[model samples]
Target chain A: MNDAPVTAPPRAAALALGDDALVLSHRLGEWAGHAPVLEEEVALANIALDLLGQARILLSLVGDEDELAYLREERAFRNLQLVEQPNGDFAQTIARQLYFSTYQLFLYRQLAAGDSAFTGLAAKAVKEVAYHQDHAAHWTLRLGDGTAESHERMARACGALWRYTGEMFEPVEGLEVDWRALEDSWRESVAGVLERATLTLPDGPRSGAWRAGAGRQGLHTEPFGPMLAEMQHLHRSHPGASW
Target chain B: MSSSTDWPLWEVFVRSRRGLSHTHAGSLHAPDAEMALRNARDLYTRRNEGVSIWVVPSSAITASSPDEKDPFFASAADKPYRHPTFYEIPEGVKHL
Candidate 1:
């Protein structure tokens, strides 16, 4: 038995991944009472719970999970801008899930295969993320092909969020991932799903000036501020109070 | 919400473990067979309560009329011989 103390996971990578899970979990939690149907509400809540569990595990690796999650300023969060985007509509939320879950599944699969601090967590999380990806893909297909209104909404949502996807390929300081390969696989996977759903890939610039990125650099979009305020409200109002 | 009313209802069955037959768990609404199965998973199996699931359109199941329950189920009520109550005790055969 190796008795050496385990070193802490790289802070930057943990924060980025943890923040992504935490923020997205909160957004999904927002759908609790508003989902279109009872079954869908339960499904979304289950996915949210899974993500919250993952966020707790990842955040705990860095520092006090509550402090890092509840006390962080908007600019201090390292999550990708894709997750912080508002849940515009059911279609929009599904579109965001399709994009982020695909990226997360692939990233976690890579991490699980390698020797890293994230290996154990990634191994477990990959299974949950796979289901998340499947759920999103199914919704994407149904909404994209169901009816004129649904298809239009789905298309609009996919296009609206296309710009933020490029940031997922940006290399963080600590994670040893092949960004190019990850991005390529992500494009192929997403394109296949969209094609099958009868929706064309959005024709827009994914990166460069005027496109979103830099969330990993502790910079965030406008909506993140309000979201942070809401997430931190109960904790911030009564410090260290527990039920 | 209005659109969900247009969706079909499905009956969910869950098999708690291997070698056991599926038991009717409950019902839920979904757009199709695929979504119904996924929804059933979230509803019935999230607590580790099931190892397998089957979702059938509520329309597909032809349930006996509750109004005719007496006539439909009356045949077996007076037949004690139809049950295997005479079997000897088997210590390890729990489900039987």
Candidate 2:
């Protein structure tokens, strides 16, 4: 007599995706009231909202979204190391966006085409991530080719974030995206953008001890602890209180 | 044109639906037309408020000054015949 869908929702996959969205959303939200320009303030906030929406959906599939987001320990988060990196500068933020959004769009496209628990979310999110990728790409090009200082900053941002790009292609459970193909596509697309932006690619291997990221395994960076404390403080302080 | 950033101001218009005219949403700063359009999308359409957006450089637009309001808009203000209300509705005609 039980008629619920037989597929148990994949907890780990949901946690990973949810954590990625939540972490990146918070990072982007950090730009509120601080973006270099008014238009960019709106742009970054919109992107943050989009990521927050995705995080809410994905997190709810695994557990109480508010609790999961607000109560998780530093090491308990399953986001990629790339997203948890601080928003060092405008150029750095754009570099992170360019890498992450490209991978997200590619992965979401595959998820949207498949039969899975994530299909509906992926279908909706793919369109949003497409715009995110375009926004990042647009900024990357502008910064890379704009002026000497801007170009230098853009180049440094790209190189600094290059290490974290490898983890994006790591396969998650319950999703059927071809990781290798997605990685290849991501590389080609990013390489094309960088070429047009007149920036050089990083020169080191992305998977060795120096470049590998373990945020997928719940390992985060030094900055993550403080960022999480800041994000979760209000919720932890006002438990069960409704806005 | 007045600031150190040198970012130009662009006016934003958003069309909420098909067959409807694009209405003025607001304005924002951008370095160029491409960024202006993207800024318009993010700023004006974040709430699903638009399907299409149009951006125009504020400097490119010419308008009758508010000081000329009497001469520019006064004629239309008193023209009652310009509205369809001047025509009588035939017997059972509705919606007109």
Candidate 3:
């Protein structure tokens, strides 16, 4: 019997992660035609494009792109809870972006430097993320120090999103991707930047809890159902539709 | 400096990744030179197009008035003989 090496255990897991990115990118694109300001709209669109591009690479590396995106059920998504949250308002959207991009920036930086099969992907992805971080950091400074209402809104948005922060760093089973060495370093780096911007790093939650343990196991938050239906409708309804 | 009541608009120029010359990117609102530069970095360099950026307050710019259009430099257009063209091809001009 001849043998080719079996696929890595993490393949499905990583594809799930990639799907999270792709879905979130699509959601962010909804803001493109309707952001509060023209400049802000362009910024969000750019960030969305970057993430979508990253998702494509990550998905292709793992398996078939369409299947990775469409075949998966709502429960299979592994995005942090923050990303799946709806864009409630301008402040809320920016706050979600800032939180996710901050975390993604850290995650990508570590992966770029680490020993991983996805080193090439991570390296290029990290280059794009530098801009994402800058975008978020800039807005954080402006909104935090802006007019009184803006300041209050930012604080509230951060407070709401902070609870989702833990999901970013929380480990998932069989994903087995490790940034253990860079964990503290990443945290400190983001903390310093936030401090310089004069924004507080929002705490996780008052419930003293995180929605964990199920992301990788095909379990998801309540919002995932509608997001999936919208995302996968065409592909599911008309199988084999293509360019 | 104290008399300045509003934020001075800054024009950003970015030199993407060791590029020789900086190109005008866009503008951002900021109070001073240092803040403008930082904002420029945040807005322009975030995409990593730039290894460096320059921000100059829009007010500090001294530009020739478009209203004085014909009088200012219109004289140069008629002076073609003021060029080196008149003497350049005389005899053997080595490597000219």
**Across residues A1-243, which tens digit of lDDT does each residue of candidate 1 receive?**
135565678999999999999999999999988988878989999999999999999999999999999998888899999999999999999999999999999999989888788888999999999999999999999999988999999999999999999999989878878889899889999999999999999979986786888899988889989989999999999999899
Q: Considering only chain B, report the TM-score of each candidate against the true chain B.
A: 0.78, 0.79, 0.64
**Candidate 3: segments with Cα more than 4 A from true spot:** A1-9, A173-183, A204-213, A237-243, B1-62
TM-score of every prediction relative to native: 0.94, 0.91, 0.78
Single out the weakest 10-residue window by summed lDDT for candidate 2 chain B: B1-10
DockQ of 3: 0.15
Per-residue lDDT tens digits for candidate 1, residues B3-71, read 677989999999999999999999988889999999999999998999999999899988789999898
lDDT per model, in order? 0.92, 0.90, 0.70
Candidate 2, residue A205: how far the Cα is off, in Å: 2.4
Q: Can you give the lDDT of residue A100 in candidate 3?
A: 71
Candidate 1 error regions (>4 Å): A1-5, B86-96
Error of 2 at A234 (Å): 1.9
Candidate 2 residue spans exceeding 4 A from truth: A1-6, B1-5, B75-96
Candidate 3 lDDT, B1-96, residue by residue in tens: 112236667889998867479999998766557557765665787656887888887877899999888899897899888888755586866876
Worst 10 residues of 2 chain A by lDDT: A1-10
Model 3 pairs whose backbones collide: A131-B46, A163-A204
- Model 2 per-residue lDDT tens digits across residues A141-179: 999998989999999999998988988888887778899
**TM-score, cand. 1:** 0.94
